[model samples]
Structures are given as structure tokens and as C-alpha cells.
Target: MSARIGVVTFPGSLDDRDAARAVRLAGGEPVALWHADDDLGGVDAVVLPGGFSYGDYLRCGAIARFSPVMTEVVDAARGGMPVLGICNGFQILCEAHLLPGALIRNDHQRFVCRDQQLRVVNDATAWTTDLTAGQVITIPLKNGEGGFVADEETLDRLEGEGQVVFRYEGLNPNGSLRDIAGVTNERGNVVGLMPHPEHAVEPGFGPDRAGAPRSGTDGLGLFTSAVRSLVSA
Candidate 1:
């Protein structure tokens, strides 16, 4: 059976449909989950897509963290359910304490939108199993407060534990510490990244590579990896 992947839609979410489409393209069934509902609809995995939830009020993802649906997502994630957060959703994961560190304003103090190159630093995570360590992939990244910051100790711990999943390959758009673009929980079940993988899952819509045509569909691996993880489990 196709894996059922839940894509949560908050009031201000902009990429919920894109995430669902990505899941469907990856050969999984997409289940639309609502922020007001406390149920996950028995999905095998969940994706918190990129968007300015709650208008990014107070702080990025600060208000959305307490939404009723997040309670269930937290519980399910703790039970080893695969959770992937992208861009604004990454902020939500950090706010929910599912992931460590916080996203701050870009060091350049400007909203950045570009085709970012990222290296797969750790392939053990549920969302990155199909990638090999050191492999570079291009994906769309668009955010204002996308810089990742944490205490020195926390950064060390993440590095020491091999939890840093993806790192910026070329120019760091947000000035994230250590050029970190993504990280995963210790169990490797939960992953969060500042890039929008859902937007890079399709051919014409994805980023363009240097020596190739606009064939950058590397983001498809993320969703397919989740399906593989669920099937293997």
C-alpha cells in the first residue's frame, strides 16, 4: 500500500498544497491535516510545509507552535513518526522543541530567494535516506528570518552527535552558524530544514543546475525517503 503522508495546513500556510503534491508524486497518499484539528488521520509520516503561519506574528512560528494540531504532531513525532519541516515549518519545529536551535533574521537583514545548493551531511534521517553523505543538491530557499542560531554547546552537541543533516554548499544565504541548513533529532525520525523541498520536487518548477537543464528534482528524494522508511518499518 502507498504510504499515507499528512501535510498540515495552518491558517497562513502557503505551501500545503505543494507539499501534498510532492507526496503524491513520490507515490504516497497525501492526507490534508488541519491546524485546528487534534488528529493526524493515521498518517505514516507528516510534513509541515513552508509558509508564514499566523502571519509570523510575535516571532516566526511562535504562535503556531501552540495550535491544537501541534499537540498531536508532537505526540506522534515522539512515538517515532517521521516528521519533516521545511522553511517556516522548520521554525515551528524549533518552537515546538521537536528540533533544537532557532531561526533568526538573515545576517544580511534581507529576504533571500534563490536556488540554494545543499550538501547531504547525514543520510540516516528518515527524510534523507536516499541521499548519500556529501552529495550536493539544489533546492529553492526563500525566507527572511532563516538564520539558524544556537548556543556554542548546543552546536557542539549537534555536531558531535551527527545530527547536522544538511549544510549549505556554496554561499550561505542566511549566515546560519556553521553554514547549517538542516538538522535531525537523535532518533533520526524528525528532520527540519530551511529550504523548501516541496517546491523542488517537480522538473520545470525546480531549481536549475549549472551544467544541466532545469532538471533539479533532488528534493523528490526527501518524500521518497519517507515512503521507503514507512515501508521498511
Candidate 2:
């Protein structure tokens, strides 16, 4: 059976189409979901694309966290449904408590835009199963408030339990605590990060790499990993 991956579209979402395209490119059927709608359309997995949801009012993802669709998303995620969140979507996952840590303003107080290198810290998660631990991948990262913060105890727990899925390699762009770039839930079914993986899935249009032609597809592993997990499940 073909895997169906849903990409949610909030009012201010800017990357829903890109996420859907990534899903399609990864050999999964892309289902467009609305924030106000409760239906998931029976997708096997879901992706919350990056965007300025609710105008980033109140707080990033604060308002979208309460959207009607998120109610189902939260429940489904708890039930082991695969969920991936990027950028603002990562913020929503935190607000919903599906993932730990909160995104704070960048230490530099500027919207940083560049291709960032990230190391796969944990390849056991559903969304990162295609990658090998310690493998470095470059992806486009652009955001103003991307720093991740959490209590010391929570940080320790996450690290001890192998929940940290990705870590910033080389230079830390946002001063995220412990150089954490992404994390997965305890169940390993939910993953969230600030980098825009959807933007790096396609070749020629993705971030450039040295000495490698058409090498910009490093982020395609994320989408492929999710599809592989659904198939095995």
C-alpha cells in the first residue's frame, strides 16, 4: 500500500506546499490538511511545515497549538503516529508538549539564513531511520527565534534517553542549548526541528555542497525515513 503523508496548512503557513512536494518526492501520497479541520484524512504520517502561524502572535505556534486539527494531532502522536515538525511546526510541537524544549529568540537577535550542517545524533527515530548516527547533512535553516531551551533535568533526560535526534555541527547558528538541532519524543514517533528539511529535499534547488554535483538532496533522508517506517509498521 502507498503511504499517505499529511502536510498541515495553517493560516500563515509558508511551506505547506514545499512539504507536500517533499512527501510526493519521497514516494508517499501527500495529503493537504487544514488547521481548522479535525480530519487527518487517514494519513499514515503528518508533517507540520514551517511558517509564521497566527502571525507568531502571543508566541510562535502558541495560537496554532490550539487549532482544532492539533487536538487530533496530539492524540494521534501519543498513539504512536509518526509526526514531524519543522521550524514553526517545531514550535507547535513544543507548545503541544509532544516534544520538549521551547524555541527562544536567537541569541544574536537576528533572523539567520544559511545552510547549516547537522549531525544525526540518533538514527533510531522513525523520521531518522534512514540516516546513520553521526552522519552529517546540510540543510537550509532560516529563522529568528530558533534557540531551544529546557530545564536542566529535562535536558539531561532527553540526552540520556537518546532523544536528541540531530545536533548542530561545526557552528551553532542560534545558540540552541547544548547545540541541539532536533529531538524526538520518548516513543521516537514524534520529531521536531528548526531547520527546513523540506527546502533541502530537491536537487538543484537545495543548498549547495562542495565537490559534489547534485548533492543538495541531503534532507531527502528525512522524508524517506518516514515512508520506510510506515511501510515496516
Candidate 3:
């Protein structure tokens, strides 16, 4: 059977449908999960897509972290289930303590939106197995609070342990420390990033590339990597 990936939709979510479509395009069954629902429907993997959950009240993802569904997600994540968080979802992951560090407002105090280049720093994680180390890919990035911050020790530990999964390639867009763009938990099952990879999975709707109109599809590897990981397991 094909891998079944669940995409959770919290109130104010703007990318659940896009995430589901990306899962479908990646040959996985897309299961719709709700924030208030405690059940995960036995999905092989889960994706928390980008958006302003709870309208970013009291900080981004602060309210969504307490949703009923998050309890199950937290348990499953600790048990080694693959979980990927994007943009606001990344904030949620940190708030729930599933991942370390935090995302604060951009240093420039402005929302950023553009095509971003990232280098895959670690490809052994559930969400990046399809890529190779040092491989660079372009995807869309849009966020107000995208800056990743952590203490010196945590940052050093992440680098030393190879938990820093992705890094900004050319220019750091949000003043993230060490140009960090994404990270994975120690188990590598839970990963979070501030970019919107789901938006770049489809060719015609993705960012434009050199000499190829709307040909950027680097983000597809993330979904496909999860499917491969589930299938192989």
C-alpha cells in the first residue's frame, strides 16, 4: 500500500490543501486531519503546513500548540513517527517542545516573501532522505517571524550533531543564526523549516528557474523522502 501522510489543518491555515496536493503528487494518500481532532487516523507520517494559526495571537503558534490534536502528535512524534513542520508549523513544534530553539520576528521587522535558496545540510532525516548533502534547492519563503534563535550551546550542539538539516544558501533572509533554515530532532523523525516547500512541488505553480519557466520542483523531494522512508521501514 502507498504511504499515507496526514496534513493537519488548524484554523487560519492557508496551505493545508497545497500540502495535501503535494502528498498526492508524491504518490502518497493524503489524509486530512483537524486540529481539534485527537485521532491521527493511523497515518504513516504527518505534515504541519505553513500559516498564521490562531492569527498569531500571543505569538505565532502559541494557541495552536494547545489544540487537542497536538497531544497525539506529540506522543506519536516522541514514539518516532515522522513529522514535518513548515513556517508557522515550525513555531508550533518549538512551542510544543518537540523541537528545540524558537522563531522570533525578523530582524528587519518586515515580512519577507521570495524565492529562497537552501542547501541540504543533512539528508538522513525522514523529510530529506531523497536529497544529498550540500545539495542546493530553491523554494518559496514567506513569513513574518522566520528568524531562528537559540542559545550558543544549542546552536553548537545542532551543528556538532548534524541536526541542522538545511541552511540558507546565498543570503540569509531573516537573520537566522548561522544561516539556519531548517532543523531535525535528535531522532531525525521530526523536522521543521520556515519555508513553504509544498508550494514548490508542482512545476507550473512553482518558482521560476534559470532558462526553465516555472520549473522549480526541488521541494518535491521532501514529500517523496517521507514516502520512501515509510515504505522502507
Candidate 4:
């Protein structure tokens, strides 16, 4: 049987459909979950797609953190439900205390959109099981407040515990502290990142494949990784 993955659609969410499509393309069932609904509907996994939830008012993901669905998501994640948060979703995860640290305004104080190169620093997470540690991949990254900020002690803990899952390979677009682009919970079931993997799942639709060798569709591995982990789990 195929794994059922839930994608939450909060107000002003722009990538919900794309995330759902990626899940379907990866041979998993995509279940649309509303922000108002508390039930996850028995989804095997969950994805919080990137977007300006609640119009990004009063800080990105701040208001959305109180959504009814988030209560369920938080509980499920703590119970090892395998939650993946992308961009704005990552912000929500932090605000909800599911993930450590917080996302602040970009260093440049401007919105950035580009094909970002990242390294899989930790492959132990459920959402990154298909990748090998140190494997490099390119994916779509667009955001305004992508800077990850935490104290030195927290940073040390994250690094020591191997919670830093993805690191910026080349340019740190948002000037995130320690070049950290993604992180996972201690159990590796909940992950939050600033990049958008759903946008790069398709061959032609993703980043160009001609210029670089074996780089296009780098985002497909993320979805496939989650599906594979869910099945095996």
C-alpha cells in the first residue's frame, strides 16, 4: 500500500498544491488537510509547505501557529508522526516549539529567490532517508525571513546531537547562522527547513539539467525519502 502524506493548507498558503503533487509523483497518497481541522485523517506523514501563512502578518507564521490543526500536528509530531516543514512551515514549527531556534528577517532585508545548493549533513531523519550524508543537491529557495538564529549553546547542542540535517553548500542566501538550512528533532521524525523541495520534484519543471550533471530533480529525493521511510517504519 502507498503511504498517505498530509499537506496542510493554511490561509495564504501558495505551495500546498505543489507539495501535494510532489507527494503523488513520489508514489504516495496526498491528503489535503485544512488548517481549521484538528484531525489528521490518518495520514502516514505530514508536510507543512512554504507560503505566507496569514499573509505573513505580525511576523511569518506567528498567527498560523494558533490554528486548530497545529494543535494536532504538534501532538502527532511529538509522538513521532514524521513532520516535514518547508520555509514558512519551518517558521511555524519553530514558533510552535516543535523545532529549536527561530527564523528572523533576512540579512539582506529582502526577499530572495534562487536555486540553492545544499548538503545533506544528516541523513538519519525520516524526511531525508534517501540521501547520504555529504550528498549535495539543488532545490528552489524563496523567502524573506530565512535567517536561522539561536544562541551558541543551542547551536552547539544541535551540532553535537546531529540535528542539523541540511547545510547551505555555496551561498547562504539568508545569512542563516552557521549556514544551517535545515534541522530535525532528536528523534529525527520532525524536520524544518527554509528550502522548498516540492518545487523541484519534476525533471523539466525543476532546475535546468543541462548545465549541471545529475543535479536536476534534486528535490525529488526529499519526497521519495519520506515515502520510503514511512513504508519501512
Candidate 5:
């Protein structure tokens, strides 16, 4: 049976469709989940796509943390369901306290959109089983306020516990603390990242590439990992 992955759409969300398409491309069923719905439609995994939620009022994802759908998302995540949050979703995850640290304005004070190189730091998570630790991949990243920051203690803890899932390989686009691009919860089920993996799952349409491994589909591993994880579970 195909594993169904839910793609959540909040008000002002623009990449939900992209996330769903990525799930479909990964050989999984895609389920649409609205931000106001209290149910997850029994989807095995969840993807919160990148976009400006609730118009990014006050702070990105701050208001979205209280959305009706989050109640179920939180419970399901705590129960060990895999959840991947991207960009604005990352901010929401942080605001909800599901993931430590907060995303603030970019240190450069500008929206950065580029094909960013990211190194996989922890591939044992439910959503990263297909990747190899320390492997570098290029994915699309776009955000205005994507800098991630937390106390020194928390950063050390995340690093020591292998919760830092991805880090900037070449350059830090938003000046995130320690060049962190993504992180995972203690259970390794919940993950949040600033880059848009969904945008890099397709060839010829993803980030522009040059030579070998030029298909621009490096991000496909993330969705496949979740699908395979659920199928095997």
C-alpha cells in the first residue's frame, strides 16, 4: 500500500501544492490538509511547506502556531509521526516549541533566494534515512527571515545529541547560527529546515545544475526516506 503524506496549507501558504507534488513524485499518496482542520486524514507523514503564513504578521509563523490544525499535528508528532517543516513551517515549528530555537531576520537584512549547498549532519531521522551523513546536496532556499538562533546551551545540546540535521556546506545564506540549515526533535521524528527540498525534487525544473549529478533531484531523498520509513514501519 502506498504511504499517504499530508501537505498542510495555511492561509498565505503558497508551496503546499509543491509539497504535495513532491510526495506524489516520491511514490506516495498526497493528502491535502487545511490549516483550520482538526484532522490529519490519517496521513502517515506530514509536510509543512514554505510560504508566508498569515502574512508573516508580527513574526513568521508566530500566529500559525495557534492554528486549529496544529493541535493535531503536535499530538501526532509527539506520538512519533514524521513531520517535516520547511521555511515558514520551520518558524512555526519553533514558535510552537516543537523544535528549539527561533528564526529571526536575516543578518544581511535581505531576502535570499538561491541554490544552497547543505551538508547532512544526521541521516538517522525518519525523514532523512535515505541520505548519508556528511553528504552535501544543493537545494533551493528562499526566505526573508531565516536566521536561526538559540542560547549557547541549546546549540551545544543539539550538536551533541545529533539533532542538527543539516548545515550550510559552503556559505550561510541567512547567517543562521553556526550555519545551521535544519534541525530535528529529540525523537528524530519532527524536522524543520529553512531550505525548500520540495523545490529541488524534480529535474530540469529544480535548481540549475552543470555536470554529473546534474539532474537537480538531490532533494528527492527526503520524501522517499519518509515513504520508505512508513512502509517499513
Candidate 6:
């Protein structure tokens, strides 16, 4: 049976459907999960898609962190179920303490929207197993508070433990510390990133490459990776 991946929808989520579509494109079943519901409906994995959750009030994901559904997500994530958080979802993971560090406002003090290039520094995460270390990929990224920050010790631990999964390839769009674009938990089952991979999973509708119009699909591997990992497990 294909893996069932749950996509959470908060009050202000804008990419829940996109994430679900990406899952379907990757050969998995997409299950809709609600913020108010305290259950995950027995999904094999979960994705918190990018969006201005809770209207980005009181700090990006701070309000959404307390949502009833998050309690179930947190518990499931800790139990080793794969979880991928994107953009505002990354903020939620940090606020929920599912991942270390926080995403602060950009150093430029402005919202950013671009096709971001990232290097896969660690391909061991459940959502990145299809990537090769040092490989570069491009995806769409848009966020206001996307800079990742943490204490010196935590940074060191993440770097040393191979938890820094993705890094900005060249330009640090949001000035994230150490150019970190994504990270994973110690167990590598849970990951959070500022880029929207779901936005780039389809050809002719994703980011462009080599002057081609909306032809890039580098982001598809992330979803396929998770599906393959589940299948193998």
C-alpha cells in the first residue's frame, strides 16, 4: 500500500493543498489533517506546509504551536514518525520544541520571495534520502521570518551531528545563521526547512531552470524520498 502522508492545515495555511498534491505526485496518499483535531488519523508521515499560520500573529508560529493538533503531531514526531516542516511550518516546529533553534526576521528586515538554491549536506533524513550529499537543488522560498538562529552550542551540535541537512548554495536570502536552509532532529526522522519543496514538485508549474519556463522539479525528490523510506521500512 502507498504511504499515507498527513498534511496539516492551520487557520492561515496557504499551502496545505499544494503539499497534498506533492504527496500524491510522489506516489503517496495525502490525508487532510486539521489544526483543531487532536488526532492524526493514523497517517504514516506528516507535513506542515508553508504558510502564515495563525496570521503570523504574536510571532510566526507561536500561536499555532498551541493548536490542539500540534499535541498529536509532537507526540507522533517524537515516536519516530517522519515529519517535514516548511517555511512557517519550520517556525512551528521550533516553537513546538520538536526541533531546536528559532526562525527570526530576515537580516534585511523585509519579506523575501525567490527561487533558492540549496546544497544537500545531509541525505540521511527521512525526507531527504533521495538526495546526495553536496548535491545542489533549487526550490521556491518565500517568507518574512526565515532566518535560523540558535546558541553557539546548539549550532555546534547540529553541525557535528550532521543535522544540518540543507544550506544556501550561494546567496543567503534571509541571512540564516551558517547559511542553514534546513535541519533535522537527532534521530533524522523530523526535518524543518524554510523552502517550499511542494511548490517545485511538478514540471511546467514549478521554478524555472536554464531559461526554461517553470520546468524545474528538483523538489520532487524530497517527497519521493520519504515514500521510498517508508516503503523500505
User: Distance from true position, residue 67, model 6, in Å?
Assistant: 0.6
TM-score for candidate 5 = 0.98
In model 1, residue pairs whose N, Cα or C atoms come closer than 3 Å (at least 3 residues apart or on different chains), thus clashing, are none
**Runs of candidate 3 exceeding 4 Å displacement:** 211-214
Count of clashes, each model: 0, 0, 0, 0, 0, 0
Instruction: Give the poorly placed runs of model 5, Cα more than 4 Å off.
Output: none
> How well does model 2 score by local distance difference test?
0.94
TM-score, candidate number 4: 0.97
Question: What's the true lDDT of residue 74 in model 3?
Answer: 97
Tens-digit per-residue lDDT, 1-233, candidate 1: 88999999998999999999999998999999999988888899999999999999999999999999999999999999999999989999999999999999999999999999999999988999888999999999999999999999999999999999999997999999999999999999999999988888877778877675538788999999999878777
Over 4 Å off, model 2: none
Candidate 6 collision pairs = none
Residue lDDT tens for model 6, 119-221: 9999989999888999988999998899999999999999999999999998999989999999999999999999999999888777788865446788999
Query: Tens-digit lDDT track for model 4 on 120-210?
Result: 9998888888889999888999999999999999999999999999999989999899999999889999999999999888877887756
Q: Tens digits of per-residue lDDT for model 3 on 1-233?
A: 79999999999999999999999998899999999998999999999989999999999999999999999999999999999999999999999999999999999999999999999999999999899998988999999999999999999999999999999999999999999999999999999999888989887788878765538788999999999878878
Candidate 1 ranges beyond 4 A from true positions? 210-214
**Error at 163, model 2, angstroms:** 0.6
Error of 2 at 45 (Å): 0.5
Model 6 root mean square deviation, Cα atoms? 1.5
Give the alpha-carbon lDDT of every model: 0.94, 0.94, 0.94, 0.93, 0.93, 0.93
